[model samples]
Target: MTIAALQTVPQQIETAAIAQVRPKILMVDDRWENLLATEKVLKPLKADIFKAASGNEALSLVLRHRFAIVLLDVQMPEMDGFETATLMQEHESMTGVPIIFVTALSKEEKYASRAAEIGAVDYIFKPINPDILKSKVKVYLDLYVQREQIMRLNATLSQSNEELERFAYICSHDMQEPVRMMNAFAGLLAENAEEAIDEDGRRYLSFILDNARRMQKMINDILTFSRVGREEILLEPVDCEAILRETLSEFEGVIQDSGAEVTYTPLPCVETSSTLVRVLFQNLIGNALKFQNGSQPPLIAVMAEKQGRYWRFSVKDNGIGIENGFRGRIFTIFQRLHRKEDYPGTGIGLSTCRKFIRLCGGEIDFTSAPGQGSTFHFTLPSGEAARPTRSGQQAC
Candidate 1:
């Protein structure tokens, strides 16, 4: 078939096909002739073509419609194609829109390089070839349609995640209130028994109260974990050394009683969510002190170092340490090797720490062997590193 005939056939099919499929395109150029030329070149494609005579008008059309592809002219006055493409990228919905430059310039290396740098998908010279343009636009339009479908799927998935998080927060909050009430009334009954209850009855009541309190703590941790992703984290410079010192002071009584020797080199400033980082260090250090064995004083060390793209922090404790087999299981919620009477924890500390690290765009892991020592390691984005805020200062 001839080029004109070939182009005309698709236009006829597209007019009918586009009635059901509302695929759109934005055509941008300074010259009216260039704009008409692009429209003619893309006539065969099954799309709704919108025209704009300037970069500003192109941007307005982009804001109003989600175009499958943008045919842009490079040498427009005021805001050129590069500037227009950059502006389009700033919009979340337009970030992935395919941009093709239709310019009169020859195949020069500088212009070609600049086009790629500004994220143009293809470059077409003036005196357009209808057949070639038809094929090129067809390829990009098909890809754009596929991308739109993927975006729709992602939107659905994101909505589902939000719903799940809300459900967890509500369920955990509602469950804990009644559990606290049960513990309170159980304590009152134990204190004021009409006729002194038997030793067995007293033991059962104590167990009920203790378990209820533990459940309450777990529920609170679960709620915190669920909300971390939903809440907006205020990023700021945070002094790691100061936060650690304050956390140590909060556990002063425990440190003194256990005779734990805690030492740390100076920590550098890092950009992060201060509250979350404090909770992170508190849990790690507290675990170190809590798990000591054989009455040997716990020797804890906290250190930080710059790794590529992230800062790696380590908390090393010369305490009981974990077995190699159970190392992976320790970070999971309610997955404890020791009984409640022995460890005295609800087994939610490490799980909460993991959640906090993830919220800060980081990861937490560990290495341990029985009776040696355990070192918990975590990484935070280094680009976000900054001087830490003062102690007790709220993050903004």
Candidate 2:
């Protein structure tokens, strides 16, 4: 009767239908009687059993269908079970397929060890026990079913995420044109008919233009956020120092005008997406410069230290820090701690930083005290070999 239970009814029915479809199991034996006897034993499990008289036939059948498990015989004509299992493992699609070797050979520890070395999940002696065989086969069958369900769920979730991103991109793209028109027309009215319009009308037009501009910015930010991990990103060796210098160059005017002092140590060369890391640094450094106390100029320090397989980078500033209450909302999209008049931002910078950091296999967080300043820290996966140079300091 509850809403949550009601919503799951359809999914439960669909799962029951999926469960009704029999799982495929392959049995490889030189003897038809053995295969037939095993098939009879597994009948209660309701599996679609396929018999292979040779290893070659088993390999061929494996290529054609996705099997739940393969029961292989040790002694075959040309190719035996060990060789067959090794060959099957070489194929990309047959990598995780559980192979159980059924042999009538001597009960030596070496044979079992050899079977294990060749990727056999279990070794069963000749004259298979009906109950034991059924139990072992059922365990693998249940595992295969669970794995299939997980794969389907992951695929469905991925498709849903792609659709949501596409929706956000399209919605934001369509909204830009109307906002552009509003801003342009309002600007033109204020410029061309300033004398004809009253003071109140001019003020109203200004408000419209300002709001339109803000809306346009918000739309653009949304588009950028949606596109963060949408496409395939190639990882290459990117010099972190070079990325920082380029980001700072873009904010040259702001740094000069604010009289903010910036310094950084030599950064390591990490293997990651250049574009994403640059966005992260740009946002963090830009925020450091933007949020400042009126009494003193901003002092920003960018430093990096190697921690295990990650490079922990910190951006510390001597600007107005975040209050304890607003810390939780600081990294949320469109969540601002201050009024628009105080700090002119769409509140997407830190969120974008978080997104980009996560996309590059990292995390972002900050330590702040109100009126003292904040230090934003993030980690990046160091490449297989992070080429770090001599550490020295540079001021700008």
Candidate 3:
């Protein structure tokens, strides 16, 4: 069957358009004749050439319009070019605008040198060569256009990502209520009709109920995965040792059943999302116990060691190690190594763990050999990278 929704989703996400507006150039000079001549030379370039008679006028114009480049005359009556440049530095928006100082060959050469010291990009001698001026200004204008395009593309991409995440969240949420109802109704039928229904009927109902529960779990996993992308990344100092302990508490039943021996050291505080941190630890620890080798108890150790600007964390486990062939695809969505009957899972744990680490500006990877066990590793920025919190003071 041909699906149309997937094909149209991308187009819908790209609803925001990027505008190709003309580049804006600001010209400041004391004499109208100079401004008029410069405007005539730049006319062929097809830009919005804005002329300012004084340095104060130029500053006011920049406040209203984002200029690609500023053409400033060194010798202005009230506010000289040097003072104007200094004042523009105060206005944050004018900082990046390339300034080309216009100096006549007849003027004092020291003004040119002074303009250079004042952060002017280039000096164009008076009796300005029209061709040279156009070409040089064109270079800056082209660069400005390219930078604007990048900003537009980034905005569009960020919006698209948010939309897709919201879509997944809505689908998973809507899918849950019906699946829960199915499981509940199936259970009721099985209980009330136990005497009337045959053994085969009971088995069929059990199969339906089991499959429904699995579907519910898969939907929940999808919700969890999508939720991370929607939530803002809160980078604050988080004590990894505390988070590890909390994560282990969640898997208490499984840890006891598997006779797992979990050990960890004083994991230092780091800049990270507290929620995703817990998810990362939970998945890694749960995977260790779930994929145990033979009947032997699982041995898991969590550690965090400082690595210059960031902290390198590792969860080493003695369990059924990953096969080399499956390493690359192990973190992919819905990709699993074992069957549902053997090792039950929605195949989203590793993928979600990777997503969580990425959102926190960190990376997660692992090393394993079949029967040799696996070691999952990741790195997060140290607390020094984040704003200091009073509660996160260097405490235990």
lDDT: which candidate is best?
A: 2
lDDT of 1 by residue, 187-296 (tens): 89988992598989999988898888888888887788677778888887887778999999999999998889999866767788788779888899998998888568
lDDT of 3 by residue, 1-396 (tens): 113654654664354334565789999999999999999999988589999999889889878888889998877888988898888877878868899988764556777778878888998778889999999999998888878777776787776667667777888899999999999999999989988889999999999999999999899899999887677778776777788888899999988887889999767777677887888888898888888865789999988776777778999999889888998889997898899998889999889988888877788989999898999999886756444347533332
Of the two candidates 1 and 2, the one with more favorable lDDT, higher being better, is 2
On a 0 to 100 scale, what is the lDDT of residue 172 in model 3?
89
Residue 116 lDDT (model 3)? 77
Q: Give the clashing pairs for model 3.
A: none
Ranking by lDDT: 2, 3, 1
What lDDT tens digits, residue by residue, belong to model 2 across residues 192-256? 99999998998998899889999998898889888888877778878788999999999999989
Go through the candidates in order and give each one's C-alpha lDDT.
0.81, 0.85, 0.84
TM-score of each: 0.60, 0.73, 0.75
- How well does model 3 score by local distance difference test? 0.84
For each candidate in turn, give its C-alpha RMSD to the true structure in angstroms. 11.5, 6.0, 5.3
